[model samples]
Target: MKRLLAVLATATLLVQLGTTSASAAKPVRSSAIQWMGHSWWPRSVGGAPGPSGLWSPANATVDAEGRVHLRITRDRKGRLVQGELDTMDNGWGYGTYRWEVASDLTAMHPEVVLGLFTYGADPAYGHREIDIEASGWGRTPITWDYTTWANGHNPVSRTPVVPGRSTHQFEWAPDRITWTSWDATGALLATRTVAGADVPVPYDESIGMNLWVCGCTSEWRKTPATEVVIDRFSFTPAG
Candidate 1:
């Protein structure tokens, strides 16, 4: 009888252990990266195939469900260039969404392309783009603009982000129709009122590239290739 009780107790313990392990494996907020395949890799514009500068795949990776993983890194000369193509129907077509970039902006260049979305009227309904162009200057901030063939404009906002040491978070809550930014310390840097009226949703919009580049004013620098380091990128439903 004692041996029987011992066996029963051991079985119960094993069952409890299994339950606990399963519970611990539940999907966490940060780890919820969907696998996005090669469909999103960037394509060059000209005959050379790619932008005027040079770009290549990094330590970044992708998964099965079409979620992408990337680590943005600088080159030997403290420069980097990387971008991905828009392969899926991003939230811009319709619906509310949020995007987050956990970035370390040190003594880098004076320019960055955090994210972009195309907005314009065309049979293509495609070539339009919204840009979050940032310069390394704090008080000068960065710029956000939406452009199209028929109608387009550039609007600048003062972000006052400190370079050399900072992790920043940028968010867009379309339901609220506003954009917000916060520092690593959770301090609000700037807030801009965005409206469906002001920035109309592109009917078939998509997320293209958690991208960054060196030139904000011109094409690539004097060099043929430049690169930047990206730690990771994530997108979630924005309230």
Candidate 2:
């Protein structure tokens, strides 16, 4: 966790609190990274993607298959560059957010990380963040970490990411938040829920996706590239 825990440059995070991740990012290949019917803005915080290295909008692009690709690469300067995107909509609260991953996460570099989550910039409700992240964090057998933060405490659920298409989701309401995972065949991989005051209330939070070199240069020195593909993101308000 540390500074990267819930800290996502609140000043910048707030800018992405534009609209819900509905049908807006349209998939446009070879140019702008428009995909899945929503608008996603590629961003760089302090010239880097949080916790280290540089960021390039080029690393975030849409494929001909209509998938969102988040990647990490070594630039001509030998600088490790990562990628992240913020949804261009706000007004989202208390809803079910789902992301379908098309990559084989288990094959990714141990130090490389991919995250899909909702976040805000204020201190309330721990930056109003909830995350579904896949990374080994220098460990083997890449795992997916599901987390909900409140104040400074974060409740997490870690589970192995299966091969093939996988869907990660969280349903947030006024009283509770439910997290679930399903494999390509719709087999339940894991599920967990948190209720009461700890479950963060929805504010001006929006969706985001990122791929970064987690262990920094020490680990990335060996492999300067990695990537993950997000098939699409969908949201349904908790009515």
- The candidate that wins on lDDT is 2
RMSD, candidate 1, Å: 17.4
Task: Give stretches of model 2 more than 4 Å off.
Answer: 1-33, 47-50, 216-220
Q: Which stretches of candidate 1 lie over 4 Å from their true place?
A: 1-39, 42-81, 90-92, 116-128, 136-151, 163-176, 210-239
Clashes of each: 23, 11
How would you encode candidate 2's per-residue C-alpha lDDT over 113-204 as one tens digit per residue? 78888776656787687888888777778888887776455646889888898999999888888899999999999998888766887776
Give me candidate 1's TM-score against the actual structure: 0.52
- Of candidate 2, the 10-residue stretch with the lowest lDDT total is 22-31
**C-alpha lDDT score of every prediction, in listed order:** 0.37, 0.73
Worst 10 contiguous positions by lDDT, candidate 1: 43-52
Which tens-of-lDDT digit does each residue in 132-235 have in candidate 1? 43444222244332232212343535455443323333344433234555555766666665444334434434454444444535544432332333333344
**TM-scores across all candidates?**
0.52, 0.84
Residue 7 C-alpha lDDT in model 1: 31
